[model samples]
Target: MTDPFAPLPRPRSDLTEPPDAPQALTGGSGVLQGRMLLQVSPARVGLLRPQLDAGRSGLVLCGPNALQQARRLRREEQFSGPLLVDPAVYEVRAASEEEPFPNACEDTFAFDDPLAVSLAEQRAMGVTAPMTPTGYLHAEDSDALKAAVRRVAALDDPQVVFAAPVDVGWLREEDSVRQLIACLRLLAGPKALMLGGQMDPLARHPRAVDHLRRIVAEVPGAALLRTDLAAFGALAAGASFTAFGAGSRLRHIVAPGEKAKTSKNFSTSPHVLFPELMHFFLGKTLADRFAGADGPVCECASCEGARTLDSFASNAGDRQARAASHNVAVLMQWLRTLTAFAPGLARQRWWHERCRTAVDRYPLLNAQLQQPNGFKVPPQLKRWALAAPASEAALPRADAKDYRSP
Candidate 1:
């Protein structure tokens, strides 16, 4: 019998590539090979050249505002790496100060009327931008998603492809998965799945991760990616590769569109995102501020010489690039570490163990996964998380109002 779960066929052009050391990735001589991509805005694309030169490999992602800039770079023949364009069609596509992006609808039908608004007033705050037509989103029905794919594909680069219906978080129905799978199967090539917006990667809605894993297995050639470091744990679930948003909070999601700074109280930068935690700290300064006499907590290439408190005050572009570079390092190291663990569930277990340790080390980090604003956690994932070793023991007791991760 044909196995539905069997691996899918590879792309004709062979879009995906072998990692720097395939043998290191897979114990087997001819084993696994893949690329770790970077999801950056047009402003950050320049960072790619250095990363590429540094022996780091990954794709680049951009929003609409930077699309032309990215294209110019491509046409200039400056960057030879894969480039991805995001089409945030989950909601109304509109122009914002940041760029032209698909933003959450101003008024979700759920609260179209004041009556319904009051009925669920408590949840009103939880509903973020891009509430999506049916309380979630899908590119299958979006012409924008289709058009984006065509536009990117038309770029005539095998390395390019568009990511749509980025998240299946609100896709609660089995048919939803099946339908989306049908659309996914029809994608041209160099397929990539994005876990965008509202997803707490560490504490993914249980079903969303399952759906994601299913996609990875079914389309073995597709890249399972997340711009947000929060969802980096998806790597454990059999994701081929993950791009760090420079670990800056700016590397975020929306249906494909997806925020921010200070002094000592500004230890975290609004734009500078930290992994394992939902909060953003003051930029390089915060990172430098936290630096002990020995040195900054992060000695990543980007963080070097950034130990000065004023260094954190570096302009957004410089600081963003530095933060992004550091995140690339973090993801690559994990990729290598997981390589030792064969493939499949074994890799996931390795990832989970590390995540478990991190959560245990800093319980506050779990705040990102808590799905604040009355948002319910995916039941399946909540159960799965609870089953982890010391899961409940490590969590703040229900009565504990304060959680300080010292």
Candidate 2:
């Protein structure tokens, strides 16, 4: 399940100069003078006054709802940072609608070509569409991934972005995995962001960590590696900044492996999952534990205002909706934490302590579940199921400088 000795692809020679050079890639304009990443649904974009006012560095609209919300917010709210919309959102555009924005939001755009505004327009607004990986990789067709990367690289502003999380699913073949990593590294070039996508559900095996170690090793220059809060603490060895998932992935099944099993004891559907017994239950509980943990010590409103564990549990709603909103808030909080750490090392000790604190709490959840058939989950099985657990192996370490500046 882990790729070893994969033929690493050499760096590509096509060096396209960014038309708008020196400007930040995404999310660099808020009151916070650091890097940030946020994923919001369209429904909540209008309500992001808290996020925009909080001084977020940037926001990435994941789905149509998020993109529509961003466009609406752009009209309503006066944001200071770069804004991003995923390409998938543009695909859903109604031909009747005008160009999605008054102007592009960031250095790189994420929408498809038909909906894409002119490069001149993006440059004028300090926006670019540095191609980003959508976690949909076709293993048989490396060229497709490479071609997508090339198209993004050839943009007027060539800032490549990808979020190909290395997890158990990706571990099916070590060579292909290595090739994918090499391809990503090549795509990112001298400077790129290796944003780690969610690996929580896929982490049900120990080899997942091995795969993660290799993925981290192959891309040491990533701007930041984002992940789930609970998983982040459990797998801190591979990352720099501690981050968490936005629950979109949690709500939707990534593959057949994650489908709910009908058990006499507990139904696995989102509606049936309880919010409290996360380890013991499925959906809602899984999301609540990850979002409420404060594993990253994020200082955002959601983290601070979450009066109690119960409050955090209900922040988003029932199962799926809760995962989406809570995770988005957590990711927003992560950006805030990064801002506090940047421009200096003042927050390094605090960051480590936060991670350790979270890691320490993981076992307690398991221990609490073991109260006379309360729910005994095996540590070996537990450890194996994470996307990137800690490893004794000496994986490569990305320099803090890669993401220290705006």
Candidate 3:
């Protein structure tokens, strides 16, 4: 019988580290220059202090206490990198009329109001880049999106970023996505942040994914927020930057009116990133798979020479903290590797090749682990792997108005 706990073979090319020849790109906000941002709740601020202090990543504060957290990080931790507070106004707009608000949601509304009020509050909190407040973009309404874009364009401060939180399913409507792209183009600067409400990881439908690709490709400085690993696909499609949440709930937007279950049957394991596979699994699931045996090893700064893939299984707070840190470190390495290449075709090709390799290795990894059906590649990842490198000449221009909605 094959040793299911044995380490899987490493890929021929190392995709985690930067190459020696190419010079890393600089200038502009790190977020706009292709660096990944880490979004975390106030309670988890200290968890990523190492990365924050080292300037390896930027931070986006979410949750009700985000303002207070930002103030503390600046006053106490002295984190000087790009920092922003998510106003989370989308939650209010997403809530169904009769649905009761969660504690977090209620607290968010107590501070963050819509439009100008939220911007003012963020400014007072000393947010490095204050995002213009926006409401949820439902499939049927383009007015809210249009107004949000215009509001950002009219703002005198260039540091303001346009935030567009939208229904993930709305991407299926070709016209709606086009409208979004058009509104984004109207912004004074190339600083637009897209939030996919209830997207989980990403849109699975082919058309929806394609539409997302179009938005990322067409928008000059488009970045994805709360995207999780799907941020890789956005980066592949030429996004300026992406942010992944530190925990499962923060990883994706919760749909309006969706209430948390009160059930106690849920597993307490923190989700750990399997870098080679480019997917996250419950730590317990990983422990079970590698029971009594060694599994893949991570060389990320957090895991180097000590933590193995299965070691993150414990549900203890400290273990969860380490798991989160390890995940960020691994993602930062990948970002460095991706950004090392010249932008456009070179970067896209490298990402596609990496995805392809991950896809091909899935079967072998599963077979070796003695679980033939396990480790399926996500549909979006498969799409990226199979996608041809986008031609620079064919890409949409920043000012293209052909798809603009009336």
Candidate 4:
């Protein structure tokens, strides 16, 4: 039988180059700290119009909203922070397609179509836009890769051309990984850059860490490292600073789990998923858990604290809007923090205590509730975390009010 997970060969190109060392992230950290984080969803923007005008610092436009809000902000001259738009289609194409952009939706679905708002359009809006390259990593043709790089570079703003590194495990082939890294080097040119991707500790073993480190060594600029909030603790068991995305793991909850058995089970519902959790505790938990491992990272306001996570989670109207806005806030806060601390150990001790206690109390969460198979914590990881100095026993109990972390 063919091994489904086998690494495929990379396309031959003169573009191939060895990975560069992790560029020290210094300037942007301070800009991210203590700012209002805003996200664009149809509903959040409508209800939380006040937040947008009230010192909001960062903006994250995902899915279809990326084009709409970006244009709106530009027209109204109301946007503040450097807007980083990660078109939802970018990830969709990367994760769902096997061949180079097999899922490139060529219609007017808005969010799914990359051409709707080209790099050129972003430049016209005076928006500091960044294209999350989903197809570049997997493209086989040299011209296609060059064209992808050119498309992002055309925007004429370094911040606008951001690239998401390898994430989906299904797309983790060596050639694809190498191609994506190479494209970053090319896209980055000389200016500093930042890249982020998912690295689940429970799923990504020591070998995976080594693999990540190998990838880290290749990038030229500050690379944002993201993981499941709890997983971030596991990854940074001893590192100085760790970066988190409100640790919310922003994803579509359109599908139901293996045991879920109702029409409502497969539909989209924010209250049930707690999307706001990503905004509430992702960064602090990461910092506190690893003793400053996430010491200086960029994200929306929830992590930075401009708006209370609880308030965002329980907003009276538009759960998706609140969550999305919170995510934007967190991203901005992260960028500010990175600038302020600029190489300061991104630290957090509070989250550490809570996560530790939660695991001890609710072992079921650590289990793979998301996976089809029954969840089981790997004994090796459990033992490894236990053996460490900031062991579970050293941490404090979780507070009932502190649902933000863990």
Candidate 5:
């Protein structure tokens, strides 16, 4: 029995490419292979331009006006990277028998037609590599899953990646995940993008986290889109790429018909990523925590010398932009560290060890803050640390040869 997590021998030349190299957008090449993409709303494009221009991967995702946004990014910001316009087809009712959800389809381009038409729409938006138009699949809907598979398998264009936006509930059932994986295996190309609707952080959903690990591990070229910190775990599990949302709204797929909850007193706060903890905290909350005690200090290029992590909480007008930049810098730093290792068991073990150390550090941080329960270790961190590497037998035999980590 082979240890799937063990490092596979590779030529030195194969491992020397810089971590931030641009992904190839052509046939049989994974567009996002081994890359970390920052999904930013149009408003934050200016804040993130330096990083994007420096070759940090980026994704500009919009609804119906994708072309306008992409054009603005290129013309105004001079941004260079892949852009995706979400068809938002998931908002439309997939079937007449489906329960009525609030229809938000008007904001999205009509994708109820066919995959080729959807690709054509994206091409017009200047997307050289487009994703197939897929609807949100409800849990246990085998018919819908099969239909999506057929739609993707019918496409001969290797540049078009299969996209599936599914209810997160599918991750709760092993059989459901297996069925989805089998369907993805049947696609004409190995690359696929997965979006989970209304998915909480993997830390909160232990079952989903485990199942997600399995999905990425078995499916070569699988990428998790519009996700949060959990994207790192998926990358470690063999995902070709992962995208981090710039804001809360972009972090997870909002279920169709769901409205944003609001109140007069509601205010949005910027969240800062604490690389040491591998979790995000509200800027103010982090400021409060480090007020009287020593806390982890970030040394990323953005905050190396003068700025402290707590400075993100300052009432400065540019606070959000600063925080967002700092977050990307820290994340890129982490990515570079991970990619430094050879891409197999070596990288996997390095990540597992990182998670384990983070889990252990929570207690020390709590003690330092004089609050016993102040820092609860994220459950997903513990899971990542303890998860056993998948055995060779657990891999989908058909796509087993395609399972190379980026």
Candidate 6:
């Protein structure tokens, strides 16, 4: 169902993405959701058929020396059904706990730790997305990411041009944001944008909000890619596609300075989302608060009765994956619905409605949203907020108060 080449599905009248999702979108099992893509290591190609059988797509992203394993999987028929393979440059070296920060001046990909997959090899493989070794860049290297984009294209390979990730943290800075967008504006053809790294802070930042509009305008044809599981809002904002993983960690970017690590345990469950508030509460204690709140607790078949306050107290990872699955499922459904609405009009309506509902759901979160005018609520959104929704009783206005950093 996820043929990357297939044209985007027409928007449906019953769409439930942002501005309008039924409670079920956030409540059910996300496994087998057709639009969802499972990001896996080369060895995990075994998951291809299982995910495909369950109505999902499998994507294999290799790093460093994983080409051989990727080739083997490609050679086998079990993984050939509409698959996408890309090269990912993960960590260069393990981080020293004492020296947590890598030089911001250095390439995000370590210099010595290079891509094992060669140009000849990549061409022979006939992969899906041709990705050059890219990661976070130093402010000096804003040009580096754009340079990498050209390097990947010069090879005359893959059908899609995937840009390396833009560190959201860096994108929040005024100068860095200008440089990155300026570099992207220079690109001649379309490319996929992967926004990564510590997100919550970036999401709340003022500069990042306005810059997002420029990212979309400059690279009008560029695809906005999301792996940062919480960026469904970005889809409404302008991300064209998304990437997901076999485990929860794959769904979000690794720490800026940290090397990639695998967890043997399945992610635990009950990471409940108060959609209205956009607040996430981990563990059973927080989830129990929503018991009987219809669709608040995950009811994915896997966690039918297994998800509970007791299960989380034990701190099992399997429990976390359940909630994560539901979260992705909701996002997938949201993307599906988005296909039906026009980008600007529908998305604006959706964003406003979600904020309205969010305020209605939890006024406390609004306290954070109300943190003053310097934030990016988008001009259209700000206008909408000023009109009908903001004045509604749903959002109780707080008396003028001093701003406190979150």
Task: Please provide, for model 1 over 1-406, each residue's C-alpha lDDT reduced to its tens digit, 9 standing for 90 to 100.
Answer: 3347634333332223321211112211011134455666666666644544223344444444544654565566465454444333333342222221232435556335421232143122211011111111343344434444333333333322334435444334466666555544444344556544543433444555556556655553355544553234445454444555543333444542342221244434434434333234456534443344332354434454444322444545566456556555445545555554545555555545555544443434234334233122233333334334222233223322221111
- What is candidate 4's lDDT per residue for 203-320, written digit by digit as tens? 3343443334334446454233333343233222322122333213432111111122232222232322122222133322222333412232323433344333333223345644
- The global Cα lDDT (0 to 1) of model 6 is 0.43
Ranking by TM-score: 3, 5, 6, 1, 2, 4
| Candidate 6 residue-wise lDDT at 365 | 33
State the lDDT of candidate 2 residue by residue for 1-406, as single tens digits: 2225433333444734222222222322112123344444456554443544244445555553543455455655655455654433212221111322212235554554432343333233333232242333422346554554555455422233443423244444677667656665554322322222233433454464455546544553333323333333222332322222233342212322234434342333332212122222344344444453432232334445443333323323454444334445544444454444433233333334444444445556655544333334434334433323223333223333233211
What is the C-alpha RMSD, rounded to one decimal, of candidate 4? 12.7
- State how far residue 158 of model 3 sits from its true place (Å): 3.3
Residue-wise C-alpha lDDT for candidate 3, range 1-406, written one tens digit per residue: 3347634322223222212221222223433456567888888877775754244368888887898998887888777777888877666554222211112333355544345666677777777667754655565466555555545554533456777667676677777777677666554344545545443435445666667778888766677877676576677677776777777677766655665432132366777888888877878778878884687777787777587888877787688888888887777777666655656766666667777888888898888888888677777677767676756344323322221100
Count residue pairs with overlapping backbones in model 6: 12
Number of backbone-clashing residue pairs for each candidate, in the order shown: 21, 23, 0, 55, 0, 12
Which one wins on lDDT? 3
* 100-180 per-residue lDDT for model 6 (tens digits): 122322433555323323333554664544444455453335445545544443443224344555556655666876666
Model 4 collision count:
55
- Clashing pairs for model 3 are none
Q: Which stretches of candidate 6 lie over 4 Å from their true place?
A: 1-82, 93-126, 156-160, 173-175, 188-190, 199-201, 244-248, 251-280, 288-321, 364-406
Model 5 — TM-score against the truth?
0.79
Worst 10 residues of 1 by lDDT: 126-135
**TM-scores, all models, native as reference:** 0.54, 0.54, 0.79, 0.49, 0.79, 0.58
What C-alpha lDDT do the candidate models reach, one value each?
0.41, 0.38, 0.65, 0.38, 0.63, 0.43
Assess candidate 1 and give its lDDT: 0.41
Error of 2 at 19 (Å): 17
Off by over 4 Å in 4: 1-42, 46-57, 91-117, 136-162, 165-167, 170-183, 189-218, 222-249, 252-358, 361-406
